[model samples]
Target: MTVLKAADELEEIVARVGPTAARLLTRGEEETMPEIAEALGMTEKAARARPTHYEHLDS
Candidate 1:
């Protein structure tokens, strides 16, 4: 499996999801979904949906 640990991988995520969402998705695992939503300036549902939506790209 490809691990997204490099800057270019993160930059790709940033390009696809915007900096806030990409940062939140990648670095905000300790935070709750509500907190992630707040940090990303999105609704909780949107925050929850982000992973499933983008996870396929990793494969």
Candidate 2:
């Protein structure tokens, strides 16, 4: 993918999940996958995928 396209995708992902992630971090709450999925309005499977995606970005 092009640099611009990759940046845009990263921006979109942050917009979608950044709030929930920040809230969870500040609250210091341990949440289950189902709880996270509910908070994000996503299926559990999709929620599970997010950590892997983040890990990839981290690396």
Name the top lDDT candidate.
1
Indicate the residue-level lDDT of 52 in model 2: 56
RMSD of each: 9.6, 6.0
TM-score, one value per model: 0.48, 0.48
Residue-wise C-alpha lDDT for candidate 1, range 14-49, written one tens digit per residue: 556664454456665646778878988999888777
* Regions of model 2 farther than 4 Å from truth: 1-31
Candidate 1 worst ten-residue window by lDDT: 14-23
Worst 10 residues of 2 by lDDT: 22-31
Off by over 4 Å in 1: 1-31
Writing each residue's lDDT as its tens digit, candidate 2 over 30-58 gives 45767887999999788776765544443
Candidate 1 clashes between residue pairs 3 or more apart in a chain or in different chains: none
